[model samples]
Target: MGFGSYDESEQDNQEYDTDFEDEDGLDAEENAHEGDIEYEFTASNDELLDRLEDIKDNQNT
Candidate 1:
């Protein structure tokens, strides 16, 4: 006997629709933002290289 009385097929469909409707889809769209905000991050070449090295070392260890 099953643990609960609810049907499995109906539950699966409800969960599927909820997942699709809730997705933001920002990353998937070609031009999702359309220039709402401007963001920038700048650093010297040496500083960028140092950060890269730190990341590599962390991954190796």
Candidate 2:
């Protein structure tokens, strides 16, 4: 019964609340977006590959 102590008998007498339903938050369609996205990247394939290699080399140290 001291501070930070554990009791096996107290564990058997405990009741846990299992209710976990909440309708006031987080709807499935709240962030739905319907649109066509278009973009153009000016970086060439070789430039992007060199940058990625540089990042990998930096992380190895």
Candidate 3:
């Protein structure tokens, strides 16, 4: 056994308790979501571009 050498028989066996009885306390069936998402944007392309330009211009000041 030198600097970085390790004996195989010296290491202990590791066992983990992988049993997580609903971690975060939310059941899979209860957290299930079914819905239709709709997004409505009131700003036009020109307006959005203008706002973005304003943001960039303000960042320089």
Candidate 4:
């Protein structure tokens, strides 16, 4: 079979990459912290309590 009629005006008007800048047209800084932030590994009892609280709150909602 052959392709039917099409309308090109329905296509997206903006470019995907350059749409995120400020009014002056510049990319903003990504991270607030200087350099790259690193995560520390440690075991904590707070994890279990926080998880249980989250579950309870979600259930109540």
Candidate 5:
């Protein structure tokens, strides 16, 4: 066979070590809550409507 040729005899001799531990503590299944996210929009309804109207006018032009 060539250099990269696949051999059926060599497949049976392969050994893999599946026993291993993660260095970080993330291996265990645990849920860690970070914090709650809060958002506040200061724009009024009239201001938002005006902005939408301006966008529509600019797109038409």
Candidate 6:
């Protein structure tokens, strides 16, 4: 009558162990590099406008 058969007694004797020390080490390494990279666009507004004009001129030609 059901889609599938599931036995609950099979899982009554199983043990699951999870360790967090390894995960904590990985998180610490990731946090250390959080401040290492500086994310910023160094291009000025005038420089960007000039590049856009150059592209437009090329497309027209």
- The number of the candidate with the highest TM-score is 2
lDDT of 3 by residue, 1-61 (tens): 8999998776766567777785746677877879988989999999999999999999999
Models ranked on TM-score: 2, 3, 5, 1, 6, 4
* Candidate 1, pairs of clashing residues: none
In model 3, the worst 10-residue window by lDDT is 19-28
Candidate 6 accuracy as lDDT: 0.79
**What is the per-residue lDDT of model 2 for residues 10-42, given as tens digits with 9 covering 90 to 100?**
999999977768875688788999999998999
TM-score of 5: 0.40
Better of 3 and 4 by lDDT: 3
How much lDDT does candidate 5 score? 0.86
TM-score of candidate 2 against the unseen true structure: 0.74
Question: Would you list the clashing residue pairs of candidate 5?
Answer: none
| Model 3 CA lDDT for position 60 | 100
Task: Give one clash count per candidate, in the order shown.
Answer: 0, 0, 0, 0, 0, 0
lDDT for every model? 0.75, 0.92, 0.86, 0.70, 0.86, 0.79
> Could you tell me every candidate's TM-score relative to the true structure?
0.39, 0.74, 0.41, 0.29, 0.40, 0.36
So what's the TM-score on candidate 4? 0.29
lDDT of 4 by residue, 1-61 (tens): 3598656764666456655546665545654466687888574779868888999999999
Candidate structures ordered by lDDT, highest first: 2, 3, 5, 6, 1, 4
Q: Candidate 6, residues 1-61: lDDT per residue as tens digits? A: 3678767787898877666576555565555654476678899999999999999999999
lDDT winner between 1 and 3, please give it.
3
Winner of 2 and 5 under lDDT:
2
For model 2, what is the error of residue 54's alpha carbon versus the real structure, in angstroms, after optimal superposition?
A: 0.5
